[model samples]
Target: MDNYRPVSFWFDSLDDPVLDLREPPAQVDVAIIGAGFTGLWTAYYLKKKQPRLQIAVFEAETVGFGASGRNGGWCMGTATGIEHMLSVPSLQAEGIRLQQALENTVDEIERVCQAESIDCHFARGGTLNVAGTPEVAKRSQQWVEHLHRLGFKDSEYCWLDQAQSEKRIGLSRNLGAYYTTHCAAIHPGRLVRGLAEVNRALGVQIIEKAPVFNYTRVPDGSLLLSTGRGAVRAEKIIRATEGYTESIQGQQRSMLPLYSMVVATEPLSPEIWQEIGLTRRETFGDGRRVVIYGQRTVDDRLVFGGRAGYYFGSKRRALIPATDKAVKIVEASARELIPALRDPALGETVFSHGWGGLMGVPRHWRPCVTFDERSRIGWAGGYTGEGVGASNLAGRIMCDLVAGEKSDLTTLAWVDDVPRRWEPEPIRWLGVKSIEFFGDRADRREANNQSAGIWGSLFNRFVG
Candidate 1:
């Protein structure tokens, strides 16, 4: 097979052309930096809520060239638990509130697509969290219980016993699994392209190939963003640069970028699909140190992804077909769960595309929306690898902030700037690797205990 190319199964059939706003006007009412989900959605909502507001978005590269285009398109509600927000009770409440608000983001996305006539391959078949080992099953059970305590009575999530899970997911090696009906998969690239079209139809200016160098608070209370070709002066500014936030200088440099990678397989034959039995358009992931996530595409291909390599590097270097050891692990895990997958034909399945991108993760995993009243600068980031839905909610909150609406969105506590210190450069380079190493050890030990059935009682005691 040829080396993995950047083939977007999602955008393959879409006819929407890329937006070219290379030269923006001198000023606008609202200026958004970064043209991913956050930037585009922010512009969309701002126009919806305040139609008269002149909005302009500046993208460093082409739109959706960032994580928004290259992520594992699972648009589930909140994935990160409240553990990250327990430190601040107020923020914790807001996190829960935002989580509730976003419970239907997938539905909202579908609604928008249908209304705007955007042809994104949208499916609502839910997702499965497969447990490779007993330890993973134990954790899945605990997570389900946690969701119960959080008052999730929707019956969307159910625990499957070994036999049931094996029959349902075609993964006999799995100890058990937790299934949720709320999650859905989409072609992320196509979704972004459609949203860009919708935004343009609404007269929002999207400038691509226009990298913003810096922004300053003008004496007249408007902020001026200096770009490579030209500058945009706006009444308010929103920073939606998720992983690329670190590239910004000055006070907003506290954010750190985390890289993640994904790989997609060549379309499988009907016989292979019959053997796999994963035909129900569901996404699956096993709870491991280097978590593996995979979903069946509409065209019967399996797209899988996991954590990036040990070092902090660019996507071009870190996430390629040759360097995709993580994808191999996922492919192996797939075979392990489905004994039929051990066939040489299945093992030889070529990956069509492999790519990676960065997402911003704050020391504390809570999402942040801050307002600088003096300069009218607003910012949002720190999605911690779960920004698909959070970014949509963030765009709404950002619009509310711009409109000066004193709703719960503005009341959400913004993360105070922590000391801008990362693990020393060399150490930082080794950070992900270290986590992978230790996290694997912990998971393996837990799996061993669970397989022996001794850990269940212990975990039950802890839960009780």
Candidate 2:
């Protein structure tokens, strides 16, 4: 396990195309802090809407350096949750509107991928929320009932029996599943790289390897972002630095950067594909309290990931560089979910890559997009681990907000939803550590066909 390489298989397999970089413009109409999906998509749509705007994207590493490139790659319309919708009555209407918008965003992603001729292996296979244990299967049924209570039709979300789940996922021990057609799988690294090029083609300047320290409000009412080389002034500044938000001064308590790890097996043979029949390559996860996600890559490899690393004090130690233990846990969970991988004869199932990255979790457990016109500062993030499709939505809404257009996007639930700061020090540390510990125990209990009890309920209320 110590010999495990920490590089992403996607990065290793593909030659990174050079990005068009120029010295950060002395001044620009807009300056974006991070060049991940949110920044790129915001630039892309902003330029598309108003071609004459001067936009510059600053990246500490490169495009998709964070979760954008290193995700399970499910373009799903699940950003808004029922609980978030019901958080308050005033938010209900906006949440419902946001939910519909997110569903449309899934289609918009396909539209953009086709229009740009981006060969990122975009597949329209749905998502299967499977249950590997009886307890989880019961919860899956409850989920279906909950959806029904919310006026959803069976066509939107349907419960599948054990045999049907096995037929779809080829996992022998699956107790049941909840299937939805509103999700797709894509090559994350390829998609984000292509997006950078598309934005560049549209006259967006991308400056890579330029780490942003902080921003200052200039006397002229513009924002100046301080970087290694020099300061770049802009009429508007966008903090698109999702998990890296803490790197900027005064924002450490804004969002929790949690590390999630992944492992990918080498390309399996045709016989192995037949045995592990993900014919449509649907993205999948189970009903455990500890989240795990997986997808069948375009090259016929299983790319699986899970959240097994949790560091307190908002340290985000998991993927600053992934620990060997975290990667091992993810690999083991993948094997546990799909027993076919444990077949001794399939020595070809050796893992070829292991990697980890950070996802931003808000203090209030809700995703948000906010812009303060007075400060000329805006940000869109905190999707937990569900930012792929949501980022596109965020980009569009941010464009509307920055342009001072009072459109429907501005009326969404997440707009200006600034959550409270995380508590100070040892209190914060103890709370987070306890939550993670209970989550692990809940997963084990569910795996043993037992209930998660109060701890699981607490987890759902806190971080679900």
Candidate 3:
């Protein structure tokens, strides 16, 4: 296999090399700086809105090669820091409205996939936020009640008791779960690669292996995107690099890149699946403060992952081995959650693939979909691991912003809410490390039937 294939199970499964190595064009009306979901979706909507506009997407690697291609494949309806937005009276209404729009975005993705004939293995199985302990169960119920208080219908968010949740998913100690019909499981590789092809058909030029090392406002007022191979000048530049944003010159602290890892099991036998449950293929989560996510593949494989630690200095991974320490941690979590995974009959072989990648989190933990008229630069990202479906919405809003249209998309809270720059150097490193430490300790305390205590409180304040 090539180097990119080892990035994730989804990437490894693709039949094509997905290498679009053509050089970028000299000049264009619009220049996008990544071939991931954000850039591709932005291009898709732009072409749909204005077919005559010239657009080109430049990527550091192949399509979906970053977090878009290597994420846990969760097309969730909720964006990070949304609950925080709901806490304010002024922003609450807009937050609810955003949630509704995200729900529609889920269907929109399926619609686009069907219309474009992209078989990304998209499945609307929803999600089960499982509770492993009585304390967590109580907390989970309180959360559901809070949602109801905020006018969320049961169809949108509801609670399932221990017996009900266990019936749906046979987790080791599942006390209950909060189910939401706003998330889906998908093959990240297929979705991204397909979107790139759709953009091609729409006459959008995509150039891979062309990294935008820097950009500046030229004397002529056009932005100059400089790359190793060449440079391009455009009237508008879209900075769509999510987790890898810092790689460019003069953008070191724009967004923080945090690493997450995953391991997927081989297609299991019917008997093993019976012991495992998740027949509907609903995505699973135990609400660990440390953060864990999983899904059952169309091929009967168990794809599982969780927090893979923050690398010092926000360094990102290219290709990870099956034996990586972070991969082992995720594998252990999978077995701990699902006893079927630890069966003696299954023997030593269980997980088939393991990989890791980065997700961008802003200093304020909010997403940004905005355009600056003066600079003529529009960008969207800071999803904090919610890029799958959120990127679709980002694209639509970006289209409006880039085209100078004053539509609903351009008026959302995030349209002008670019995150603040990350703290510099050792402070940034220490803060990230401390958060991970507290998160893990909090989960451990909860497992022991104690409150998350100071550790949990600290984590909530920092991460939120």
Candidate of highest TM-score: 3
Alpha carbon lDDT at 80, candidate 3: 85
lDDT by residue (134-174, candidate 3, tens digit) is 77899889989988999999988999988898889988989
How displaced is residue 61 in candidate 2, in Å?
Answer: 1.0
Please give the RMSD to the true structure for each candidate, in Å.
4.7, 2.8, 1.4
lDDT of 1 by residue, 304-354 (tens): 777645334422332334255665665556556555555686556665666
Q: Estimate the TM-score of every prediction.
A: 0.86, 0.94, 0.97
Write down the worst ten-residue block by lDDT for model 2. 1-10
* lDDT at 397, model 2: 94
Candidate 2 residues 134-253, lDDT tens each? Answer: 888887798688767766678877898988888888675677799988789998888888899898888999998787899998788778889865898899989898888998988888
What is the number of backbone collisions in each predicted candidate, taken in the order shown? Answer: 0, 0, 0
Alpha-carbon shift of residue 386 in model 1 (angstroms): 1.4
Clashing pairs in 3: none
Give candidate 2 misplaced runs (Cα > 4 Å): 1-7, 17-21, 80-93, 316-323
Best by lDDT: 3
